[model samples]
Target chain A: MRVIVRTVSELCITAGTLIVLFVAYVLFWTGVKADNEMHDQIDQLQRQWSASATVHPTTKASATAAAPAKPAAYHYGKPFAIMYIPRFGFTWNKPVLEGTGTDVLKKGLAHYARTAQLGQVGNFAVAGHRRTYGDPFLDFPKLRKGDAIVLTDGTTWFTYRIDKGPYKTVPTDVEVIDPVPRKSGYTRPGRYLTLTTCDPEWGHSHRLIVWAHLDSTQPVETGRPKALRR
Target chain B: MYGWIWRHLPGNAWVRALLSLVLVLAVVYVLFQYVFPWAEPLLPFNDVTVDNQ
Candidate 1:
């Protein structure tokens, strides 16, 4: 009788163990599915907006001669999401937060509190990771002066072309936020985009900077392809 | 029957304990797998995306 009782207990336990493992796997799969679905939807939206873009992405299109009129809605505090970066092939449909802390970086897009807004008439600044944890800016090193960095606030997509430097070892010098980075008293050019990322991944000893001037700011109705805006 | 086989197969106490833990996890997982869907509201950050634009 005693032996029979022990055997029954073991069988029951084994059955329970199998069930738990299955549940864990299911939960994990569910989360992955949700994330992927959201990402796909955002990409589809970008395609619809950028259908007219004529250039093969890897090569810069001959400098676009036409630039769109600055949108009147360009405001200082409104949020924007990063629809995609063709140069680096990063497509994030998620809402972009303005800061680069662990949580915001984990999502996508950091607002670059130091730079100017897309239509603000100054250098719009933002930063992100170059590597580690789905690093969107990993290939930023390859971008050239004319490559486009697209930003959107869902209603419009703003394109900015690469303008300059992969600045190195520039201490966090909050002064970089002072309209002009690294240099003092130099008059900077028109509306620009400044993107910064940590170099080498393992160490934050240096900063990698990429600058771009506004190419065009297109509203959702202005024929901007959806694939370029999420 | 399968129950008879389970009752007779003897394993060390540690082994049995490990197996018991595995069993418990499996049962709990199954319960959660079916039960969690009904409790989505209680989960953290279900609507992670917000249109701040």
Candidate 2:
């Protein structure tokens, strides 16, 4: 009987250790790995943007000439833009990768492939992690109605105003990303941005959304915009 | 099962300890690389929608 008790105790210890390790992997190790990958992605994007800038001088005429061309065709899992939320922090910026695939989200925020292109006349929807994998949108609930959600596609800075939400809804609400989202107060089609992250900090049962309208745009060579000045 | 593994390990106490550690690590690697990813889709993490329609 004593031997059996000892064996059972050992088994319990092993099981407990395994559970602890799994929890650490999910909550901590994943974030470290994701943070490293995000840094690499941002560095690569900066390099590409600088190379492009050198190719075309930073004149307004050149910027206008370069503007009409739609963002490069979507390449799945590629980082294409950098998103900055002034409400988050002055140094807070995340690379926006294409595709919402699990692998892509592990690296940084992902753009919904089916949504409109960046700065276009439709909703440019994006999603990011809320709790694990660096928790890029951990402070999502703090976004106010006028917070600036700035995005740059290497050539122009598109500053959007929080016109509607920080709305709470279930995971199944897709209408939030419509060209004219139903509850966003906009009637006609226009340039819009929608950001989504899992709600409740650690739970994925619901989603938190914020909708914004494009307020202004400027060429990258013109220096930091007023929204990012501070 | 524990007794069987112990008998077949064929090593001194320290060697057996190292081998057991390696076995545990291999299990962790497999679970993270294969099992968790396969199970991820069934989880509620990535189910957000753009519209109900």
The candidate that achieves the highest DockQ relative to the unseen native structure: 2
Measured against the true chain A, the candidates' chain A TM-scores are 0.59, 0.95
Q: What ranges in model 2 sit over 4 Å off?
A: A1-7, A59-69, B1-11, B37-42, B48-53
lDDT of 2 by residue, B1-53 (tens): 46668778968988988898898889988877777656555555554434321
lDDT of 1 by residue, B1-50 (tens): 44453455469767766776776577666655676444432332221111
Cα deviation of B31, candidate 2, in Å: 4.0
Predicted candidate 2 versus true structure: per-residue lDDT over A1-230, tens digit per residue: 97788789889988897778767767787789889999999999999989988887764445452233467787889999999988999998999999888888888998888899998889999999887778899898899988999898888888999987789988878888888998888899988999988877766678889999888888877777899996
lDDT of candidate 2 vs native?
A: 0.82
| Local lDDT at A72 for model 1 | 40
For every model shown, the clashing-pair count is 29, 6
lDDT of 1 by residue, A1-230 (tens): 97788778877987786566545534454445445543553565456335533333322223233443443442233334554567665443343445444445444556654456554676666765454334556676677766767766544567776657655444455454455554423266566666667655534556667666667765544556543544
Reproduced native contacts, each prediction:
0.00, 0.24
- Global lDDT scores for all candidate models: 0.53, 0.82
Q: What tier of docking accuracy does candidate 2 attain?
A: acceptable
Q: Which numbered prediction scores highest in lDDT against the true structure? A: 2
